[model samples]
Target: MKVYISADMEGVTGLVDAEDVQPPGRDYERGRGMMTEDVNAATRGAFAAGAAAVLVNDAHGPMRNLLPDLLDPRALLIKGRPKPMGMIEGLDSSYDAVLCVGFHARAGVLGVLSHSFMGHEIEDIWLDDQVTGEIGLFEATASAYGVPVVLLTGDDTACAEAVAWNSSIRTVPVKYAKDRFAAQLVPVAEARSAIEAGAREALRSLPSAVGAGARTLSVRWQSASVVSHLTAIPGVARRDDRTVTVTADMPQLYRLFNLFLRVATAVTSNPPYC
Candidate 1:
């Protein structure tokens, strides 16, 4: 089996605040270390489960958070962003399964450090009329390539969301959320064990964890101006001041979603666009 891992920072073990996931924060470096360890655990587990190869994509801000030198030597890492596929970049039908590590709840949800792709711009993401967080978005992208999301690790809310999307998916909840920036967490060692075990169990379950069929995707921005800026893309329709809707097959929808995020990010934070 070939396994692909998409890793994020917000849901890593012991992460409960923005400072943990961003630079200049006292614990930021520690958070990256924890994130790397968690991903290594998952990769190790996948190899133990008979996976012939594993690839990890760093899916957080700037997409370069994962420390390449410390990552598991067995797996290849895709870092940095502005890529066509974004989170699920390099994913294709060739992979046997995909895994989401250190993921968080959707925007406005009660998970620790909860937010969609761009917390400052996206208020919610909709797929086929259902509200979905980052978990759903990445799953859809993987599904588009005929890959199943076998495992997910994060806080309680993120784990719950994974199972809700696909009951067969295995999840390792490293922490229980008390609020947006507060969580009851297990020690790093325990969290690593859980992730490793969860990856093995999820892969062992096989075909049951893979499901794909997304027809429409949409997003609601934090404000009308953000949505207005995104509507400039052809085929993207303005649903309302805060919402924009797009109808496409899974692959197209995934690309459109990434495009929306990139444009939104540029408009909101990048000065050149402003």
Candidate 2:
């Protein structure tokens, strides 16, 4: 089996605040080490389950959070920005399964460092009326290529969301969230063990179940200017002052979502743009 793994920092064990996940912060360096270990554990599990190849995508802010030198030598790493797929970059029909490691809950949810695509700019993202975060979006996008998510590792809320999305997919919650910035964490060693076991089981079991065949992706932004800018794009409809809706299926839906993300990222907070 071949697998694609996407790694993020916020939900990694022992990390709870922006100081840990964001760059140039006091704790950011330590957090990346933890994230790297978590990815290595998952990769080890994949290899143990007979996976022939694994690709780890650094999917967090700046898209370059993982420590490549610390990653499992068996797995290839993809890191950088301007990636159209964001989290699921490099995903294609050739892969048999996907593993989402170190993910958090959607914006406005109770999870350690929770937020959707763009931390402060996005309010929520919906797929065919179902409120979704990065997990849901990644699952849908992978499904578009006929792939399923075999294992997901994150906080308690993120694990719950995974089960709600697809019960068959395995989950490992390294921490239980007390709030957005705090959690009751499992020791790093224990978390690594759980992730390795879960990844092995997930790949050894049946294929991951595909999610709903969503036809629309609706985004509610935190700023009206984002809504205005997105509306100018052909086929994007303004649903309200803060919401814009787009229609597309599977792969295209994923593509348009990223396009909107890039556009929304450019919306300035200064006047005239705000």
Candidate 3:
């Protein structure tokens, strides 16, 4: 079976700051190492469950945090920015399972870093009238294609959110959150074991279920400026001052997401400072 792993950073076992996920910062390299080890743990678990192929997508910015040379030789790694699928890049229905590693709660979750896509620019994102963060929206999009998420890992808030989105899936929480940015963590070694075990269990009995079709997505921003910014896309329309709406079917969501993310990143972004 083929498996896809979408990996994020803020919810990684010890990650606590924005600087930690970006390169050249004092803590980024260490954070990236921690993220990779978590991915490796999941990858190993998938292998144990008889997966024939695995693909790891670096869902974080810059998208090059995972060291290609060190990733398990059994899987292919897609890294870097500007991919057509963005966070859900490199995914399709043919893949049997997906694992979301290190995702966190939506932008408003207390203490979590960059709670919104753009910390100061976006307020909330929604789908099916339900508020969602990267985790729910992405997973729901995957479900549109009949790809059920088999496993997920993150801090307590994230795992709880995942359960609400799709309770059938298994989750491994690496830390208990004091708030979004503050967390009491389980050591890396202990966290790694939980993630690996969960992945294996999830995939060992992968379900055969069809997806619920075509989804409409709404992104609520901090202000009208942000909404105006996203409406530049042809399919995107201003639903309100703080919201923009987009419509997409199974295949279309992936294509649209790439464009949506591009507009979002470009408009709300200020170049990084040292």
Q: Best candidate per TM-score, number?
A: 2
Name every residue pair that clashes in candidate 1: 63-80
* Model 2: per-residue Cα lDDT over 8-103, one tens digit each: 888898999888988788999999999999999999999999999999999998888988888888999999998877788899989999999999
lDDT of 3 at 135: 80
Q: Tens digit of lDDT per residue, candidate 1, span 105-210?
A: 8887899888887775677788888899888878877777778898999999998988897776788999999998899999989999989998988898676334
Each model's Cα RMSD: 2.7, 2.7, 2.2
Clashes of each: 1, 0, 7
If the candidates were sorted by their TM-score against the true structure, best first, what order would they fall in? 2, 1, 3
lDDT of each: 0.85, 0.87, 0.80
For all predicted structures, in order, the TM-scores are 0.94, 0.95, 0.93
- How many angstroms is residue 200 displaced in model 2 relative to the true structure, after the best TM-score fit? 0.5
Scored by lDDT, the top model is 2
- Per-residue lDDT over 130-165 for candidate 3, one digit per residue giving the tens place of the 0 to 100 score: 888778778777887788898889888888888898
Model 1 global lDDT (CA atoms, 0 to 1): 0.85
Instruction: Name the better of 1 and 3 by lDDT.
Output: 1
Question: Per-residue error at 62 for model 2, in Å?
Answer: 0.5
